[model samples]
Target: MRAETGTRARRPAGPGLISKVGIILVGIVFFFPFIWMFASSLKPSLEVFSSGGSLLGSRLEWSNYSSVWTAVPFARILVNSFLVAAAGALLAVTVSLLSAYAFSRLQFRYRDRLFLVFLGTLVLPQEVLVIPLYIMASRAQMVDTYAALILPFAFGAFGAFMLRQFLLTLPRDYEEAARIDGAGQLRILVHVIAPLLRAPLAVVGAFLFIEYWNSFLWPLIVINDQDMATLPLGLQMFSGERGTDWGPLMAAATLAVVPSLLIVVAMQKQLANGVNLGGFGGR
Candidate 1:
């Protein structure tokens, strides 16, 4: 009995050596591309690939970063991306909150079927909808405008579906109690439900912001003027008949990653909780 107890006590408390090594390997695998981008940003255009995957170049080429600003209307591009992403995220979150409340809390006829139909829209790819969206935007005279960038995709069903799933998992007692106190639907959603949904809302908002920030194809199809181009479109300026300015392109990319990276890092905890409780795990 003593020997058995001692053996059990001697077992490792945390992940074993192999698990730790595997985790480290996986982290490195994911982080290596970012490292390569930053490293290549500091390299000469010619030396970017000629170094045979080595991170360091002959000398640190800080001018690549400077060249990025001069090579394109980068400032305007960054501003446009930030505005479009921020607005799109806010609009998406608001719409999701209202729609989720309606589907989950306030029921009418065939609500479940209606919700399932709305949810089914998620299966449709953006590429499939782009053509019709472009036609509508053209008809509305919104082409090359910020509205064209933001409005077309802001009403996606993903956010509404995710929020509704979370609402379904939530107890209705609080809402009922609020209703008894004569709280209106909008007031209940804003004051009661919205507060409780901070984590999931943060997750949805961050996802939307990242989606808008990194959007390339839709923006490319809609935006015609160089002044209105977003960061992803602006990056293309580095490539032309002269071939690609790899160093400057990487520099711009590294800069472009900062905002999304900061958002993800800031909301990391919320993101984790949202995934765990937001019905994303088959809950």
Candidate 2:
């Protein structure tokens, strides 16, 4: 009986061990791209694709990063990327929050219909908007301007819809209490509602940041000046029509991943909270 009980106790460990092994395998699969990029960044241009050696460089070319930066005005490109992405994200989030509040809390005629129309825009491919947006910008002489990049992404229907869902999950009693204390709409939204909104707002902001940060097509079409080009354009130029400088390309690509990683890490706790509350919505 002692031996039997010991065997039974050990049986449960099998599935637990299998689950851990599965998770480890999944993590390795997901992390391989990053590993490859970092390894390739240190490789000589020719060695980047060589199959005979190990995954990384046989002799590390550490100078690739420095050389690549000096090859062009990379700092300027990075700054442009940061400015356009950050400005677009902040503006988008602010507009989404206000639109969400109005949609959730206030009553107006044809409000639901208007919201549905907004949602309809979400299903439309962004490619469809390029020509019309370009024409408007061209007529306004806004092409190649920062406004062309930032203004187009400054309002997102998806952000409003997502934030509206989150707002629906918040208690009206909180707003009622704020109102009873003689708080005005703007005051209540600022102090009472905004405080509770951080997690969802972070979620929305993070998505917007990532979207605008990686934006390629719109900027390519609108921006003609080398001075205003973003990181994507810089990377493309690095890989000229003749051939790609793989080592330098990977170095630039690795550097490009930093801001997104930092943003996600900084907001990870709030991001987790937002995801946890996703089923019921959150604010």
Candidate 3:
């Protein structure tokens, strides 16, 4: 009887062990690049090249971070990134919310068709729009300006669509009740609907912020002045005149990733809840 009990206890352990192994393998796969980047950033330039063959290496040289910082206007680039991302996110969320509310709740002719056209823009990649956008920016003499970066991303179809879907899921009774209380549409939007939309708004804002923050191609194309360049563009400078400086480059790259990582970590709960709400509500 004791032997049978021991056998039963050990039976479940096999699957548990396998599951743990699978999880560890998956973790290693995902964590390997970050580990490599961090490790490379801590190595001296020569050590970085020498240790290239192994995933784990001997010594750590921490001066790469200071070298990278002094080599570029990293602080200014960081500020520019934050400003562009924050402005774009704020404008995108505000415009999208208002537009979505109108499209979802207001009665109008061709509303659905208009929204469908807006939704169609989602399938169009930003690469397709870059040339024309660049020409327009040049014509307006806005190249290398914050307006060039912030204004273009201020309105996004995805934000509008996501917000519209979320607004649709909300009970109309609240709006109706507010209306009966002599609250104007703007008042109701501000005092009622906006508060309820905190989760979805955070999700949309977070997404847009990350997009603008990490945007490389557009900034690389339009920003000619070093002072106007954002973090991604500035970080590209580390690739160098002769060959890539992997240690300082990785250090700069790691620093560039910090803000977005903090943003995600800080808003993770709101982001998750918003996504879930938007998903279930859409269906």
- Alpha-carbon TM-score of each model against the true structure: 0.95, 0.92, 0.89
Candidate topping lDDT: 1
Q: Which is the leading candidate under TM-score?
A: 1
Note the residue pairs that clash in candidate 1. Answer: none
- Candidate 1 lDDT over residue span 1-283, tens digit each: 9999988877764458778989999999999999999999999999998999689999999999999999998999999999999999999899988888898888699998998898899999889989999999999999999999999888888899888888888888998999999999989998999999998999999999999999999999999999999999999999999899999999999999999999989889999888777465434
Q: What TM value does model 1 have?
A: 0.95
- Candidate 3 collision pairs: none
Provide the clash count, candidate 1.
0
Ranking by lDDT: 1, 2, 3
- The alpha-carbon lDDT assigned to residue 6 of candidate 1 equals 85
Give the CA lDDT, 0 to 100, for residue 8 in model 3. 95
Candidate 2 per-residue C-alpha lDDT over 1-283 given as tens digits, one digit per residue, 9 for 90 to 100: 9999999999999999999999999999998999989989999988998845477677889998997789878999999999999999999999998999898889999998998898788887889999999999999999989999999868779889888998887779989999999999999889998888888888889999999999999999999999999989988877777798988999999999999999999999989887777523533
Scored by CA lDDT, what does every candidate get? Answer: 0.92, 0.89, 0.88
Any runs in candidate 2 off by more than 4 Å, and if so which?
1-16, 278-283
Against the true structure, candidate 3 reaches a TM-score of 0.89
Which residue ranges in model 1 land beyond 4 Å of their true spot? 1-3, 14-16
In angstroms, how far off is 230's CA in candidate 1? 0.5
Shift of residue 45 alpha carbon in model 1, Å:
0.1
Screening candidate 2 with a backbone cut-off below 3 angstroms (N, C-alpha, C), the clashing residue pairs are none
